[model samples]
Target: MKFTRNASANWKGTGMDGKGTINTESKILNDAQLSFKTRFADGVGTNPEELIAAAHSGCFTMQLSFILTEAGFVPENLDTKAKLAFEDGTITTIHLDLEAAVPGLEDTQFQELAQKAKAICPVSKLLNAEITLTATLLS
Candidate 1:
């Protein structure tokens, strides 16, 4: 399947002093503010890295759920936390911490499926950085 998603950003002034607003086609992030301080320091706005983290976590979790379902295991819950490391103006790595409760799924099988999901997720394929995953199977 081929599809397109859209998001736009409008900025003004210099890099450090400039400010921008990000808007998505779905309007989930309508007029969200972004600034240098927001990216570098602790500011009251969202940054690209944070957004990437959110997207990666959501994508990876969904992919895992699909894999689990296909493997005949119904997941009671899946929680993923994606941590992105950015340095030297480049994305260095993304780490995914996943805790899942899947009925009748073995730990080894869960780990294997989680690895497959990390490798095949759309966002993971799009990124040019190292991706790591730590998966915990809960009873």
Candidate 2:
């Protein structure tokens, strides 16, 4: 299966003066070259890092959910946060934290699922940057 989203930006003037529209629909814009990617965060005007976070978080969560299901457990809720760090003008790493409510899940099983999710998530595989994960199985 394939998934996609498109973005376009128009900039004029200079930093702090030039503003660009992203997707040209959300009306979320970037100005002052603030480095706002102009896509889905900070009022839906997202940046590349935000997009990475979105992809990573969603993929990892789904992977973990599937792993849990395969392991014979049902999760009440599964939430993950992905943080992308960019420094020296390059993305360094993506850190993921997950909180899952699975009544009968053992801690070890949860860790295993998290590891598998990190290893096999499509985003993780596609990214060359390091991906770190932490998970908690909440009762």
Q: Name the candidate that leads on TM-score.
A: 1
Name the top lDDT candidate.
Answer: 1
Looking at model 2, report the run of 10 residues with the lowest lDDT sum.
Answer: 32-41
Candidate 2 residue 66 C-alpha distance from true site, Å: 1.3
TM-score for candidate 2, please give it: 0.76
Candidate 2 lDDT tens digits, 67-101: 88898988899999998988877889999989899
**Pairs of residues clashing in candidate 2:** 16-32, 37-47, 39-45, 39-46, 40-44, 40-46
Residue lDDT tens for model 1, 113-139: 999999999999999999999999988
lDDT of 1 at 79: 97
